[model samples]
Target: MTGETAPVAARDEADPVAVIEVQAAVLTRNFELLRRRSGFDSQLDRAGYLLLLALDSLGPSDIGTLAAALGLDPSTVGRQVAAAEGKGLVTRNPDPQDRRRSVVTASPDGLARMAELSVARQRRTTKMLAGWSVEDLAQLARMFTRYNEEVAHHYFTGIDQVGCAAPHDQPKHSTAEDDS
Candidate 1:
């Protein structure tokens, strides 16, 4: 007897939201896996991790500047920084040029911890790319870099607003198509 095939639903031409949602979910899961493998998730929550990254990248920065860069409230940034300070991972000091401002910097211990985390992250990333050829990896990286740049540009240009939206706040744009 011939086997019968199951019916499959046709793709919706108008919906893109589902596409974005799925992509976001996949990226989130990948990041979670990476963080877990690197022991980052166990050591710090997302905010704290971000704080560490900012300190690493920007060197010492005043609380206000850090808060702005992180898109977090000043109080929230302060709390996270305080926690990092308490762990002896960072130091808070009065800004040399501005007595009214305080800057946060990663301490020696923090840098060492970050180095360990970085190595773990790199190892995981390398494993994930192991199946890809160098050319393929380079192409993939280029696409990702371009996408990131475009997205950041859109956000910074005020074309893609960033704020909490109620269910009613979503634009009435068609969600039936997957742009990808």
Candidate 2:
């Protein structure tokens, strides 16, 4: 039954949310399938990857600051930092301003690993979307960004996470009058 389509229940054609839900489910599987097919693997797990991204964006920070920016529990961040440290993916130093506190940063090895992962992912995506128009990709990016923001807004309040520092920006389109 490989690549067999599931039987979908007939729902209201006008129900956009229902359609979105169905498509979202398909997208989750699509990513899994694509990743497997692409053979792109990473040593960094999702949490560690995100933690590293936050560090890259904000620079060295104490656990509390990192947790606050990422909207994660400080205890959870502490454990993640510990695990990352064990893997030599991050380094912790006593804060110069306050020796009692530790500042955590992604190690050089971690940054190199992440860079490799990112380039592999980008290559995979580019190949997957080889024929897509730039406008089409831009539209999808905008929609995805909006969807992520909405989901975050619903689940978390006052989150100031990396890659979401500001509201999504769009290029201004020129009208016919503007061409004059």
**Strongest candidate by lDDT:** 2
Error of 1 at 22 (Å): 1.9
Off by over 4 Å in 1: 1-20, 33-38, 154-180
TM-score of 2: 0.78
Candidate 1: RMSD to truth = 8.7
- The TM-scores, one per candidate, come to 0.66, 0.78
Q: What is the per-residue lDDT of model 2 for residues 79-119, given as tens digits with 9 covering 90 to 100?
A: 99999999998999999999999999899998887777778
Give one digit per residue, the lDDT tens place, for model 1 in 42-102.
6555666667777777678888767655555689889999998998888998888988889
The alpha-carbon deviation from the true structure for residue 79 of candidate 1, after best TM-score superposition, in angstroms, is 1.9
Model 2, residue pairs in steric clash: none
Give the distance in Å from residue 59's predicted Cα in candidate 1 to where it truly belongs.
Answer: 1.8
Scored against the true structure, residue 85 in model 1 reaches a CA lDDT of 95
Candidates in order: C-alpha RMSD to true structure: 8.7, 9.7
lDDT against the true structure, each candidate = 0.66, 0.75
